[model samples]
Target chain A: MTNVSAELDSRFRAAAAEEGLLDVAYDVVDSPLGELFVGISDRGLCVISYEADPDAQVERLARGFGSRVLRSTRPVDPARRQLDEYFEGKRKRFDLDVDLRLARDFGRTVLEELGRVPFGEVTTYGELAARAGKPRAARAVGTIMNRNPVPIVLPCHRVVGANGSLVGYAGGLERKHQLLRLEGALLA
Target chain B: MEPVRIPPFETFYEEHKDPVFAHLRRLLGQGAEDAFQETFLRALRAYPELRNGRHLRAWVFTIATRVAIDETRRRRPMASPWLHELAVEDGLPPHAELGHLTDNLPPKERAAVVLRYGFDLPYDEIAAALGSSEDAARQATSSGVRRLRERSKRS
Candidate 1:
């Protein structure tokens, strides 16, 4: 094994990396925006990504699972199953246990508020923060989203800037634009 | 005043159901379905004392953990079938790998590690739940992590 792999493996095991393996046993899928990274955990469905950077993905996984990831043969896996239904517009509510471990206080509050944004609709950061009972925390909410533990799963793309300005997204503005278009939120 | 009976047991079950079920599911894995039913059965027997909702979730977890441990001990010397399934699903070799990490650790250490990983609990909460000093809880997690790394390295 490569030295980096060995080091990564050892660090992961030291994190007591069980339980999450089942959750991370997932497969990527082709989406309108780009390749999607969806993984599950024993607690429930976890990360749904749109980026291609392995390091960022690994760091997110490690924060939740220490370093454990699993693969499954069934292409129609739990994570994929629910997510496919979500994008197909068949499922509105998610039945997954989200791991918001990397989020805290304001970040956590922001994500929780995002969950209430409702499907097939969009909301601005200031509106979301107001719902979180901290209207001035809008900018803080935007910063919180820069490191959202579960991006697409938490629907960070659904958040727009004031007056519907397509704001910055860790997964790139293109994917954000595509997602907004897919949800029919982008204006003519 | 004679202790007044609460409404139907369903009320308590309805209140604490999901969190209790989720807790047991993490603790015992797939075996939680059965253990959950057993927990409520035992709870029914002691319904009067379960009135306090302040720690209801933790209380349910404690009882469920005890029951799971008992069932686990009762079936010792034989690989736990449920654990075997979990190991296989997690991509670990079956047979000897089922409890390779867990069976070797002490119960407190195992519970501490399980709670920490399963629920993402911090050291202090784990110590409180396991009735140990914060230092002891941290030690248990540290040692447990070390042993897991060592065993996985050999594999």
Candidate 2:
């Protein structure tokens, strides 16, 4: 992005927003853990990240989406609003549109199964892999969960260890436990 | 003529955003972003019909300058003081701050000066962008420059 006047950049953003030409528009929203960058494609919310480095994401999105990505708040507004509600314990299920184009094949299959885990429900990685028709591929399920493009909305945090221990989360185990606790999956 | 092959909008955006944005910022004062948006919006709308790839840069600049000038007319019937305070603290380029430079001149002269010196547009291209004769564009730029010099000296 060149150093255009802030006003012009905003105007450009507004028009892109109006036309829905922003291939991947994103904005940062605050959560109890930290700031999260929420991105959306025209179809639905696409990517969420713990890191908000614009330059790196811009390059990454350009390569992935084949268009310019901008920091448009409007497209991701619903995602932000819903995430806010979920984090606040006011909402249990997310009804936002999701673009899962970034997920492929087994990863896509694994995520779809994970999305069905429901709020306040817990499933083991092996259970998730079995639902995706690859019971022995529990490790693969874990890998897919780690790279889940849209995390909380997909409910990867609901996937616990096969032994029912809190194992791993892309956002860290503490966040995973917190999310489960918020959902009443954990007594504490 | 067969339509010139324009890259996808995302590719175009990645490739040209900086130059186009920098150009609009230099041409317009405060709300250059709006102009940048409008310019690209119009360009994208007409991109399919653009016949010559070689003229893309100049073409984008043409739309940018016009959008910028049009924005000047649409918003800000009266200049605000916030831009004034920002300009006074100008540690960088004097004209780069914009509010003072934009307020001091009429819209046409401002466009001419911004295109000429700010963007280094030749008189012919500036005239094309301004929808006037080259000679008139040259005169407008000259007068706009003289006013800026006098204002700076007084300040």
Candidate 3:
């Protein structure tokens, strides 16, 4: 039997993309914080998970987006490059488009505000809630931060406790501290 | 019994793609590439709703067979008789020897024979793939085999 051709594989992917069936294309990239599972949709970059289990991450993406998630580097290459630059301190702001479909309502609003916090700056959850037009929803904002899908790109680590203590990062406090220090937001 | 966990679509695709392609190649020959893509596309579209991954191989083969049937039906009206005659005179293409033998069979019979003999799938699985009774699947396979035997004898 003849081996399956590489040409056919790419053609299928193109056809799937054209039909909007290739909902998410993902790849893993090495970082100072270990491997980052980066996922992108045609809409934009959607998921940057710090989860250890790759299978669970893919399953979550399949459930959130459609099940047409494929392991291809092409769609995620730009985000990976930007992340590499950010880690190396060569870039401050992300130029790539982000897909925040995974976060909805107030959570989405909070993340949108978080994106504007800039490099090396920190905001309290209460302040972020006010920025999102809900001064009394600070604890709710904390819940949103704990569930932030696109973490580092949206800079969820920059949100600290009310007393300026490092707190409440889904990727863990150590990684958050490292991220803040990397951005010169925290004095090491 | 434990419930079967459906794997991620990527894992499912990697496991079944080559076998499904080989099955389509035996039935559709050069047209297998298109059918292969169609099979996976359909599979991916419906993958999340699948509650059971126990028969995923058979499930994909069913999609491949239906795609092959559609492709053959689409091509029959446009295919020239002389083109087929010339192909016969020139001998069958290397990757398509089985395809040539089964080309004249009814689509379901061709699929039945291929699934039964080539892939060693049971009559029940073949029935499921062909959407027929298991007895009918067995008859289709035997009749397809007999027809191929007579054709080879005459040649």
- Model 1 lDDT vs. the true structure? 0.62
Model 1: per-residue Cα lDDT over A1-188, one tens digit each: 11223333233222322322222444567655567776555555566777644445644564465333433334226556676786776777776687676567877878888877766688888998898889988898888777776676788888988887878898898877776766677764
Regions of model 3 farther than 4 Å from truth: A1-15, B1-8, B24-38, B45-56, B66-110, B113-136, B142-155
Per-residue alpha-carbon lDDT of model 3 for B15-123, expressed as tens digits? 7778788778776788788899999999878876788778788788888887876776577644422234323433433233555667889877888876665545678
For A52-131, candidate 3 gives per-residue lDDT tens digits of 45788889888888767887766777899999999999999999898988787888999999999999999999999999
Model 2 misplaced stretches (Cα beyond 4 Å)? A1-8, B1-34, B43-155
Candidate 1 positional error at B83, Å:
36
Question: Compared with the true structure, what per-residue lDDT tens digits does model 1 show for residues B51-153?
Answer: 4445554555666666766555455635544454434434445444434467677777777655565445677767756666799988997687566656766
Compared with the true structure, what per-residue lDDT tens digits does model 2 show for residues B1-155?
65555444545655677777776665565666566667888876676565556556667766787676556545653453233433343322344345456556987788787666545667877876666789999899778767766777686
| CA-only RMSD, every prediction | 18.5, 11.5, 6.6
Best by DockQ: 3
Ten residues in a row with the worst lDDT in model 3 chain A? A12-21
Q: Looking at model 3, what is the TM-score of chain A?
A: 0.90
**Model 1: colliding residue pairs:** A23-A40, A23-A41
The local distance difference test score of each candidate is 0.62, 0.74, 0.80
Backbone Cα, N, C clashes tallied per candidate: 2, 8, 0
Error of 2 at B125 (Å): 9.9
DockQ preference between candidates 1 and 2, better one: 2
